[model samples]
Target: MAQHAAVDDLVKLLTKANYDLTLVQHRLDKEFQQIYPHNANPLKLVSRIKKIQEDLSSLKEECRELLAAKQDLIDKARTTLVGNRSLLKRMQASSGLPLISDSDDLAYTNLNQIINEWTVQVRPKTGDGKHDSDSEDINQLLFSAIVQNS
Candidate 1:
């Protein structure tokens, strides 16, 4: 009878330990979800964040390329003006075209006019703070800079 009681006590202890362990695991699982709800399925959330980062990086690269292209165009236009002035001077000397009083001044004026017209037509303009109904991704910070300049 004593041996039987001892065996029963041992079984009861084991059962209690198992129940406690299960309770602790359930509590831990709940805490884990609270801590990182999005990471409940970690692989999926990681992939989504990676894709968003890639898209932002691509947009930044495109903006850089556009700015570089604009700078190159400005430089080429300036070089063309210089070449045009030289060509005009040569023509006046050899072909007997009426010479301007100041060829350099005329060239500078023409370049300025061309640049002004190009800027007005090609540059993006920013309007008021009201968002456009059609466009969703307009960055307010960048648009504000454009507005101030305009």
Candidate 2:
């Protein structure tokens, strides 16, 4: 359970960090636009744009590492659970315990259900095409505008 909690926390932190980085980049782009206007020095603008790109790239790499760490934790937990369950089954068979219906079957089913629910809850949703699509479009527009201005 603690391992699970730790993985969940890490995922949350990574998600928040990604969001914050995006917001910061957006704000920086806006500021750059305001400061540079149309007639600003090309060399300065180019340098500033390169710096922002580098920062964004570094943030993305960090996000990817965090995601990979979270996945590794989850995989370790799953492997441990599977091994434990196999051992339990072997012990039960050796002890001549009343062979209840296959416990492993039930455990796997429950684990699958829990994982499905967790995935649904943690994933970001893309709403119906009308309203939510506008945000994505706006982001693209902003990105292009920044590149063009730079």
Candidate 2 CA-lDDT value:
0.64
Query: Looking at candidate 2, what is the lDDT of residue 8?
Result: 100
If scored against the real structure, what TM-score would every candidate get?
Answer: 0.37, 0.38
Worst 10 residues of 2 by lDDT: 126-135
Pairs with steric clashes in candidate 2: none
Q: To one decimal, what is the Cα RMSD in angstroms of model 1 from the true structure?
A: 14.1
Q: Which segments of model 1 are wrong by more than 4 Å?
A: 1-53, 100-110, 114-150
96 in model 1: Cα distance from truth in Å?
Answer: 2.5
Per-residue accuracy of model 2 over 32-64 as CA lDDT, tens digit each:
778788847455678889999999889656655
Each candidate: RMSD = 14.1, 24.1
Q: Residues 44-132, candidate 1: write the lDDT tens digits.
A: 56778999999977876676566556656766877897788779889998998876656448658877788666444433444444433
